[model samples]
Target: MAEVYQRLAEHLDRLPDGFAPSEDGAEIRLLKRLFTPEEAELAVHLTLDREEVGAIAARASLPEEEAKERLEEMAGKGLIFSAETEGGKVLYQAAPFVIGIYEFQVNRLSDGFLQDLNDYWSTVKERKEPKTINQLRTIPINESIDSRLEVLPYENVYALVEAHDRFAVAPCICRSRAKKLGKGCDAPIDTCLVFGDFADYYVRTGKGRHISKEEAKELLVKADEANLVLNPTNSMLVSAICCCCGCCCGILKSLKYASKPSEAVASSFIVEYDEPKCVGCLKCVERCQMEAVTADVGGVRLDKDRCIGCGLCVSTCPTGALNLVRKPDRGEKLPETFFDTWRAIAKQRDAA
Candidate 1:
């Protein structure tokens, strides 16, 4: 039975987002925590490609009815992915552990499960996924960017939510995991925003509640005031946005140690320090979650490679010494749609 889960972990690692094996097989232990022996065996037979139950059963040599029942159960448990076509045909696919199954387990996650995950993550010394293929990107606070710059509608957080009719609010899975571990911060937990079909999934699965567009805007403001990083899905049409804290967010915490963190981020802008207006108050240094600001000979200095251009520092600058500068290195272009974003990611991950 343990060996079955070991194989399951290896199988999951081959997926696009990846689930690398940790030292001493901590990754396998985490898998065992999430799946039963039967479920583990069933999962190893699945692929990232979506397929009907009948087709999957044929491939696995299981009865169609049995396969359907098991697949539905796994989907409900957030161990697999399922989608309904417009004509009502249901399809199931293998889901990646982090941004997929682990996140979907919001409603069903237990303290024990979180502890196992924390243990597994702590044992892993290196990043599991490559930096260039991140699923999320940091964006500036809505009003922090200079109005003169040609900020695209998708670059603005407020416009992004207003463009979507469906909105849902869910607990921050990372914060929730921290809370269960008894080391959670005072930051708000229910700050994760989802949209369109992703919003519908959360609401339908009891993982989150439907929210109005107005309420979504209000949450973004509150999150900004709390110094949370606005990390939206890396897509022109974002499916979700996360209000992240450096202390709790897995992505930010990992990037803190990287020598070239900016290369990992998909930010459109970078923080610029105005030496002429600087007062050396060090407010921006204290406000930076990425540790990108520092008190130097000339008031403060911006670590161009460390800053993710989140604009949190700009909001706390009393003398207006900080501003978000559009990165000339980037062409100020984004994918036209979410499909394009996935296509680009697939190429990077070599899954295309």
Candidate 2:
């Protein structure tokens, strides 16, 4: 039983995000909490690409009916990814640890599970290799962008929302975990948005509530009003958007203390401060999640390197002292779609 979990952990570690082992063996413990011996054995046979039941059964050397039943059970538990084709054929695939299995466990989090997860996270070492791709990218809020600037459709949160037909709203899992530990803030809990197939999965699994496209846009507005940062998947065809808060989001919390927060995220724009137009209300300082703005004797000081271009400060600036400007030579172009983004990350990880 334990050997099966070790194999599963090794398999997961080969994924793009890489499920690294911890010093205290919390990774294996987490796997034990989430997967049974049979389930882990079956999971080791699965790959990233979705496969039909018969094909998966052959790969696992199990009878078709047994494989199907076990696969469905795993999918229901959010341990694997499943999707139905247009012709009503179901497909199953292995899900990564982050942005996949972990996110899918939103509705099923328990205190013991969270403790194991936190233990694993604490001992996980930072990647020594430079990141060539990111899972999420920051975009300025709808109210923050200057109309005169030419914004790409992908960089506009409203346009991304408009492109999607199906939407679902889920409770922010990071905040949920924080609240479970009695350490979170008062930010809205139901701010995470899923789209298209991912949305359908969330709704089907009872992890999230289906919402209209208009409702999703409204939620984005509400998130902005609540001073949450908008971070969509790093692809033009975004599958989800996270309305993150510095107080609750793990990504934001880690970046908050970093010497250069902007370097850690994929963002197209940066905040530009107009010193002459500044009224020293220090409103921007309060709205900034990255600690990018600070109040000085001479007025507000903008630390360009620390800003992730979230536009929270820009949207709420009383004197219009802050505005978003496109970065010169806007880094690498985003992947065309979410799958492409994953492939790119996989290739990068392989090369590394």
Candidate 3:
């Protein structure tokens, strides 16, 4: 075990400074509880790719069988993903929460850069604000995309059109058991789409891409025409990539990471739960992977202002017992600049 920890520390040291180890006091306790010293060491050495496993094992001086066995234990505890690959290969990736160091980056960046990028974002947001699941006048997800609408619905689930970056057009491909699932966990979101002043910088510098806000809106309109249920303002607020859940959406690879909160929902819809309507069928409780929902005397209780408005609870309510309502009061439902996405470029220039 000491050898494992020593080698693991060496592996951690080799990772780029950006990769944060899971060391929160609480997370530390959880890791201690969930993984053995060897497994924990292996967790520190893992990445999303399968090809890196052998190198990590060689670095640790452990036999491939030993490293592989330790990882399997972590997967059982949901600490890492060591799912099987069809070609007799083992696919290893960090579990979502363990992988959330990336989200922490976004959350951190949003705080400082959000204002600097606001002028351009403010306009892009206008087109996205009041993003409704059901637009008043729109197309349906069933018949759009020509006749490619098979068991899966849109280009998102359909492999051909999904890109990690819309403008840069990076192939954010997820592999399947047959074609090979991208991301491995099968998240419906091939990648989260981002649009802002910096997003354009991403494209030009190969840092990211400059996808016009209007063009994004057009994509949504096309999605609407296809009858795909699109989240309003979500592209602007949380991510540009529209996640397709299998149970919830045809994409976001819902089936892959449904059990893990970190890999599953990027942002949750915070809402209020009317216990009177909840029958304690645990429908909402069951659907809420976040454990944000709890049982009250009446039935289920919701923590408002914290919900990401996923509407999953409502969708699961056989009796419509749960509802994910809009939070206009908390987050300022309007951006105060609707229909100005076209001019976002000018805003960024002035900021620069």
Candidate 4:
């Protein structure tokens, strides 16, 4: 049984966003926590690409009815992915451990499960193939950008949400896990917002509730006011938005330890401070989740590399000294649609 899960872990490691193997066998244990022996065997045959049950069963060499039942059951448990198409055909697929299956377990995650996941995460530092597409990217607070710079629809949180008719909110899984480990902060827990097909998956799987577009915009404002980092999907179509904090978000916390944190995720802007207007009040320093701001000899200095262009510091500046400028090199190119972005990443993985 244990060997089955070990095989399952190895299978997951081959996906686009890999589940790298661990020396301590923690990966296998994490798999066991999420999958039964039979489930592990079945899951090993699945792929990250979505397919109808007949196709999935053909790949697994099982009857369509039998595979459909098991796959639907796994989807119900938040262990696999399932979705209904425009034509009403059901599709099943495997999902990565993080940013996928683990996130889907928002409503039902156990403390023990989180501990095992954290342990597994701690061990997975090195990998053979780096991801071509960042799982998340920083989006500036819509209201905090400099009035002069032209903000794109994708860069504005409210504009992105307005494009989606269906919306859903789930607990911030990182904060939930941190709370379980007694390392969490008072930052709001239920601020993860999803849209379109992603939103449908969350609500259909019973992990989240449907929310109005107005409610979604309000949540974005509330999160910005709370000094949370706004991270959305790395695509322009904006399938999801995560209200993150430095204290609990895996992405933000990891940036603190990264040798070159700026390269860890994509950002369209960087902070620029006006020295003459600076008061050294240190409000920006307090609000900056990236540790990019600090008191300098004359005023506050901004670490352009450390700043992810979240605009939280701009909102906190009483002196009106800080503003976000478009990062010309990286900001110029963005995928026009979510699927276009995903396909680009998939192509890189295939080439590798």
Error of 3 at 117 (Å): 35
**Least lDDT summed over 10 consecutive residues: which range in candidate 1?**
337-346
**Per-residue C-alpha lDDT of model 1 across residues 1-352, encoded as one tens digit per residue:** 7889888987777665678777778888788888888888888888766789988888778899998999888887879877677688888878777677888888876778877887888886464445355678899887889888788776899888977998999999888887877887899999999998678767766789999999999999999988899998877789889999998888788778778777778788888877899988887887788889888986887888999889999988888888888886655356665435554655667643
Cα lDDT of model 4 by residue, 1-352, tens digit:
7888878877776654667887798888888888888788889888767888888788778898888888888998888878789999888877766567878877777877887887888887686576547767898877898778888787888888988899999889888877877888888888999998888888888888899998999999999988999988877788789999998887788777776576666787888989999988888988998888888897888778787888998887888899888876753466765545555665677788
Query: Per-residue lDDT of 177-228 in model 3, one digit per residue for the tens?
Result: 2123212333332233343322332343232345544555455444333323
Off by over 4 Å in 4: 128-132, 331-333, 336-343
**Could you report the Cα RMSD, in angstroms, for every candidate shown?**
2.6, 1.2, 18.0, 2.0
CA lDDT, every prediction? 0.82, 0.88, 0.38, 0.81
Q: Estimate each model's TM-score.
A: 0.90, 0.97, 0.30, 0.93
| Cα-based lDDT at residue 71, candidate 3 | 61
Q: Give me the overall lDDT of model 1.
A: 0.82
Q: Pick the candidate with the highest lDDT.
A: 2
Listed per model in order, the count of residue pairs whose N, CA or C atoms clash below 3 Å is: 0, 0, 39, 0
